[model samples]
Target: MGGSYEDAIALLDTRRRVRRPSGALAKDAARDAGLKPEFRVGGEALRGKPGIVGMSGWMEELGHSPADVAALNIIHVAGTKGKGSTCAYIEALLLAHGAATGWPRSVGMYTSPHLLVPQERVRISGTAIDERGFAKYFFEVWERLFDGDTATESQKGERPRYLQLCVLVALHAFIKEGVGAVVLETHHGGEYDATNFVEKPVVTVVTPLGRDHVKQLGPGMKDIAWHKAGILKSGAVAISSAQEEGLEEVLRARAEERGVFGGDVKVVTGTEEPGVQGVKPDVQMGNCAVAVVAVRAFLERMRGEVLSEESVRRGVEGFKWPGRFQVVERGGGRERWWCDGAHNEMSIGVAGRWFVDGLEEGDRARVLVFSQISDSRDTEAVFRCLAESLKGSGVQLVIFTTYDPDQTFSASMSLDQQVATTTLPSLDVYERVWKELHPNAEVRFELQLAEALNLAKRIGEPGAGVDVLVTGSLHLVAGTLWWLGEGVGGAR
Candidate 1:
């Protein structure tokens, strides 16, 4: 009866009064408690979002079938720009107060578009998951979905996109590692994203809303806001940074449904406070402020108390998002490489301000290394913002490059995920934008980012003020780092 599939089914059929479900089905039953029978979308009593994980019930299955996420105290965040920075701050705050709170220092987080390395998406205690750990958990998640066998090369590519799988692994690894808390960052809309499957999180935070990801999310700001607010659930504390007029309206309306608006849990809009320590260096003051409040709320949820201001301040001071406006040393510490993931107009404007503000304070040869990461960043608009933001910075040279990972270095990232690090990126579209912005502007289109970096260093003068402003796609920052022999910690 137990030896063959037919015999087992025959035995069950003869003896069974009613079939009892277990494994994935039992886990799904457990998670069914959180689901509203009539699924709602943005406060509207909608029937369902067919593709969304909330309705699909995939998360419930993922939770118990292979790993359980029920006990993980997670701080979930979704936004356009500062999601990564905000998550970093939360992790830093947790690490800073780990000993005091008796919290596990193995802080876990999952972010997207790792600057140069893929494992950077899954960090543990402030470092990328090493190759061995990543491979172990990576295949564990992968194999679980495919009946416990290694995926072929073709099957691997056909699997979920790299970011989605990385998230699954991060959640799985965090559970296995016994991490006390997790900071989950979503790369897309709250309701529709794969990471949204997280059943329960102590806190959910959103940074300032922006107009990127229009194709997938929607055409308008409100649409984007509604999608982002999907992360909100009943009885969960929610926090947000200042939003534009349209963005605020939608977010507030949705938050109202959950009784989050105008409550202590919602907190004030992050714009009112210069909440983080010193000058905000990550992306914007609003984002840093939002992170501060969100981390405080998370700490309160985890430990039933808020961390001391000094501890929070110390974490904020030391926190740095790898490719977000980071000033790195290249060329034997002589040249300054200011790298940022200004892949869109909103971020480009900020990056331009940081660069121009620096140049104004002192005289330096500032070279602009820019490229379009995706169409989400309208090339024309991005170039226009850069042109206006850096109008008088005397940017002597502009280099447009790609983020092709294969050309730069052999990375150990699973699924052979590649960045546009080589010289083959389509530079003509961006070059055309540059030409229109500065018909007389000096520029170069290189297939290899490494060549572009070498060129920038060569074209600039040797002095403290010589800055190579490597601000465009975050992938470009990672490529530049790897090209300059940095970021080897993870990809290697």
Candidate 2:
């Protein structure tokens, strides 16, 4: 397959074969594919099979096996929120400590739903993979698994889903680059996630659990916890952040059944003061605590030594994960934009609280640009949670829009996003929900993201201070970042 980076992206786009079932069919599919089944919902099922059931076959097609995956010495992370940030903290700590240990020359991290490009999903030594490297490894995997024997000019054969293909490319690139360890974040659920194919991780971490991915994981928190805890190996240490009352029991039960290190799970509460600037005090500290505990466990359990406190502090302070709790000033400090990918009901509250807490006591016009693409989510409840957070702020403008930033930017929206946008009937729900909650505030819906941002900018023109919060969906955040020049090659 002779393909440039553009060609690679075009082919990758084809993998988003959306099959969204609804009504009774959705319920029946969920019952048959979720809860008792081993595979994730909506994955292309093998004939007579429940789900993908172990990504081993896909790995073998790419010339990798369980043994190969285990060699990466992965630190598996799964949860409803903070997975990416936790992984970022872990990678930073490992890099800060690796110099002294002289063991790991490089560390690789694999996370989902990139902010700008697909290459952002794979990072080595805390840097995103460049275009050349991305295309090189992408086609290598494509040739083996997607493109059949080239000698006979056979048509493109079977292919993994878009997210599945990204995982394979990251793993292959990590192996080729000779990284000593990989911090792997679960795509969604853990039981049958493509990343769960790793035979064993040195340690397994579960961030704070909440109601998310209900279509695939649950209608309840317990159901979601069961799927998340599936990442814990038989002998690996399971580290978790403080969860709701009785939720820890669910994790412990899963650990006991999975035989994880005598069924003992370590629960950690964050430091009173995180000592990190430009980070939220409550949520960031909790995520930091989980990361610190995970790194300490990996070192003490695997290397038989404890990490230095100084290294831990430096790592935490230096950690950076874009498109989540990110702040940027544009138009010569005349306008400010706060971006966070808070998609679920639980996280929307967190994002709102953070925004409210961080606001300066000024008469700046507050504008909200938001959108949610998940049909499984309760848009009204999520908007209500946000409304509660914004009760005190004099926010009178709310703009709901699609994720596509600009119609001319062909690569702005991913294939999955395109499908989701088409499925979304309209923004009437968002407008109606805001009207019911904030009766006096104004609400606007824009089909194009560029128009939304323009409207936001116009609401708070230059020379007049205005604070804008962009939240709800990661795709929306990504587009905002592109427009704001805050991503990849863009300016801060």
Candidate 3:
């Protein structure tokens, strides 16, 4: 049953059934265990130790030693926002420079929370591994770890979690394919993320920091910064996007403590390089800046030369990271959809403003489709911020929906039942919060993403000249694209 790609996906899905503890139970357990009260985001509740402590042993079981993993020459990147886009820029830079650099390195990129399929997490030279290739590597690692007769000591007692398995499969694929350089994005934070097991990285990057993953990585911005800065080991060249106020101090201290290459973190101002033509929007300019600096450091370390401005221009011009600030036109461009995965408080406002700035001078109708499932973020605050940004845009309607496209609403069903069956909030908190900020605006609630998108499209019909902004969660954005028959091509 686990031989085919579909079967492998099913096998992977089975491992995702670990039940998260209830809020009260989790708080109590965290207190008793001397752990941060918010450190129970996933399967960590069932494990006795941090996940990172066991990563090396697991890699050894898969026939790769620590030295071999380090030889892959990874660029470890971690942050709350822009890490994925930054990685995309770095990948583009390497790809552009490969020809001039003698084509010496086969660049690989490993990112998480795929928009479509599991295979999207691993890519070689800009293309995702095909279904047959993904299945081959997935089964090899699965059998090696779970096979009763030949299982390693660590695996004989327990199997790797979903994310851990994904990392292993990616590393296995990269090694087997002889990938010379890798751009690795941290799934959560740096210190304990499974990808941090690569003790030696050629360069380490920390993009703009913010309060995200509060349940697992934070009680404050400084704590989150510490976790992100953990990837700065003694050997790597440490770099970071200009952090908010004191967070840069945290990163610098960490770099000094780790005895990193320069004994200090190089904070990059977005002005370090001239802006690329296609790289508009203030936020992406910062991401591009950080990528340029990181790539420069990587080139100097690996080839003893500075990165060429032409290569940077080419990479920035060619870079594409979908769902960040993506614009999709439907109904032959009359219905413009501005989609972004800005779930945190800061990013919400940034994305909202960007959407508003793109609006034309005419009396254009605006639509907003938003949903967020995580209880850890300030969903109400996000709504308020978004409402403030779109004040002058004349938003005709707002649709709040869940990420699942198959969900259906039934008034006959109890609210408790609805909450139990789907990812919708237990109450109408989001809608209420939004209304408080914009009493005159009309709002509707949909149980599924497909219905929300359909309702938005109808209200924003081609002749109406409407602009729609979909945000609040990556899952919501990805689900929107999937239901629209869009593929995870481009920069994601």
Evaluate all candidate structures by whole-model CA lDDT and list the values in order. Answer: 0.66, 0.77, 0.78
Task: Give the better candidate number (1 or 3) by TM-score.
Answer: 3
- lDDT by residue (357-387, candidate 3, tens digit) is 9888775578999887776777777777877
Tens-digit lDDT track of model 2 for 1-492: 557888888878777645643423244544654434334334422222213342567677777777888888889999988898889989988888886677567899999877777888889988988878889999998888765553134534334777788888999999889898889998888876778877778899999898877776676778788878889889888989889888899899988887887578888865543433334546877787788888888888767877787777778766888888988998777788999988877788889888888888777888999887666777777877887887777777998877642121234543333422433334676677677778888988777777788888888764468889999888888888777766474111
When 1 and 2 are scored with lDDT, the better candidate is: 2
Q: What is the lDDT for 356 in model 3?
A: 82
Superposed model 2: Cα runs more than 4 Å off: 21-54, 149-158, 272-279, 405-426, 489-492
Q: TM-score for all predictions?
A: 0.80, 0.88, 0.89
Give the winner by TM-score.
3
Which residue pairs clash within candidate 2? none
Candidate 1 deviant stretches above 4 angstroms:
1-67, 149-161, 258-275, 331-333, 360-363, 405-440, 461-465, 488-492
Candidate 3 residue 59 Cα shift, in angstroms, is 1.2
- Give the lowest summed-lDDT range of ten residues in model 1: 16-25
lDDT of 1 by residue, 120-190 (tens): 77788788887567667665654555333444565442344434556666777887898878888887678
RMSD of each: 9.6, 4.6, 5.4
